[model samples]
Target: MGGGLTLDGLNRQPQIGNTRLQAPIGLAPFNSGMFGQDGSIGTDGLSFYRSFCNDRLGLLCVGGLAVAAAGRANRSSMCLDRDERAHGLRLVCETAHAAGVKVAVQIEHAGRQTGPHETGLPSVAATAAPCPVVGGSPSALSLGEISLIVDQFVHTAEIAARAGADLIEVHAAHGYLLSGFLSAATNTRQDRYGGNLERRFRIVHEIVTRAHAAVGHRIGIRINVHEDLPGGMTPDQAIAGLRNLRTKLAYISISGGMYTRARDVIIPRRTLSRALWRDQAATVRTELGVPVMIAGNIDTPELAASLLEHNVSDVVLFGRSLLADPDMLISATTGRQIQPCTDCGQCKYHTKGYPHIYCPFHPTLRPLRSTWKRRRTD
Candidate 1:
């Protein structure tokens, strides 16, 4: 059943921020980064999300908003560090509420995956270990810096609450700052924030605790169940760490892989089998007994229905497929011709050279890139 899907919270168990969706399908905040230069939701970003809401999608996770400028994955990403940022977020809330759809703001920090050219400051991470893919010499964060970051996460959550966001999904996957602290391949520290699985999850625990204190039950998280790199986060470790947080969150969104193996992990290719993480999500649902959301090669309604029917995931997140075809949900429900996504890499955004995401097949839906400056790697 697509209706009445619930994501449990501490005080209010079995409720997704007190909102129900028309279906189990939702849009993943595909980091388009076409927001305003000041990291606010500009006209383009609002219109983009509005189009999806009009398509009758259940939930919409707005594009990842950096907690601070230094944590930005790229220059074009929106930010939630200041009070001014709330204005734009309010607009997004108004638009989604008008459409009777719930929206979540995905808050994130890039960590060592970003560089000074993009953030105008040295990238920071759990350790000095360079990102396996981005290959930047990021400075390891000190105790004071880590504390400040924890506060930033809390402050941003407060802003989201004030702006009327139904939930704030903390981005703890895809080799970002929180992901770095959780993975053994990247985090090799002896402090409380690193070492054993529980210790490594200290910062995240602090963030979640403080966020809940500030914003009640509007906090959720997306975490990697299994990183692709050697000595990275294992499924067992993920389950153990999530056990520590299963009660504090509104929901747990399961994802796999760091940026090191982005191809099949983050964005699976067509050749790979669909629902790559189906078993992982099912395991999480059985063990943690908390609501779970999953995404990966879930391109059609039939696949999504099967996952929900089998109790694999509570919500199904669609990424590139929706980017390729915005009216995908409507087309599927109304028995219309649904445009197939070829799994083409053309819509990948925030890459070094390519600054925007646009499907060549749907030229009219392509976001305008007139203001985006080409990123300089030299």
Candidate 2:
């Protein structure tokens, strides 16, 4: 309404690269702790099965899944490293695909943000820089090591494609290993991997190009369009940076915050407005002329409709809302009032550090969780 965009126009399916999504709604990736400790399939696939069974579910980004053992994030996250792990991923994707849901994984490396308890490997970053929030001095990665990491990204994409993943989201955001190279605060390397925009974004360029070559054009990239730190890249600069690499990527997903600004990205503090990055997403969508996806606190269907009506972005990704009510899209379409997410931040807390994620506001989803766990483990 505000920008010559109408609800009727917005309701139409938009093409992302060569793929056409049924609707603009997407399930954004997080450390959902829905996988096993060995980074394979978890027992919660039944819940996901029910949640994603509807035709209204367009695309789902399954993870900020660990791309390598060295970058293993938490104890119970999924990975694309081994054949056995891919088997679990294949089964999960098969289930989703059977129900008409397309799945993608947000492949990532934790960089210096990894915990010693998580991966048993020393954290590595672009310039031996330590994120202020993470609080550790990381060893600088050598050129050979950086190239190897890029190769691993290509290999991961190949495995993900074979595992029936419809798309691959290269996570270069939120202070991960790739984002470390993108941000000035975390990247101080004097070599080609740091300083200025092009050099710093070299790894991402290589990954997107190589991964797309390996897995076709179903490759996307997620980035922190806004970083509220002194030495971090801001949303405006990030837009320009992305524009430079626009031709390489299939789509661009706009996210914000870094490890230091975790509250804006991971936690989504109440002080911040819902859809906090709406305008930034619009800019990316307009300037770069690509399919743009935005996920922040934009949880409600009304807001999502309004965002599309105004041409804010191409896709609206709901995080905590899906956690609260897997049937949210059905409720929205049926004009039934959907249960809202309390946004207590508890789900994020539980998923990142624990193996189970349930919405306390919707406790009936797992009435006898203890029994469910006993059955799964036994």
C-alpha lDDT of all candidate models, in order = 0.78, 0.76
Error of 2 at 295 (Å): 0.5
Worst 10 residues of 2 by lDDT: 369-378
For model 1, where is the 10-residue window of minimal lDDT?
5-14
- lDDT tens readout by residue for model 1, 39-124: 46667667777877853567888867888888988876777898777787788889988987788888999999888878788899
lDDT per residue (tens digit) for residues 1-378 in model 2: 245433343355767776787777888887665666454664555455446556777787787578888787666566677656776677778877877777877788988887565677788988876667666778999999999999888888888888888888998888889988998877888889888888888888889888877788889998887777777877666777777667667789888777663455655774678888898889888888878888888777777878877788888888888778878878876778787887676575433333455566544335535444321221
lDDT over C-alpha atoms for residue 284 of model 1 = 81
lDDT of 1: 0.78
Which residue pairs clash within candidate 1?
Answer: none
Q: How close is candidate 2 to the true structure, as a TM-score?
A: 0.91
Task: Name the Cα RMSD for model 1.
Answer: 4.3
Q: Which model scores highest in lDDT?
A: 1
Cα-based TM-score, every candidate: 0.91, 0.91
Backbone clashes for every candidate come to: 0, 0
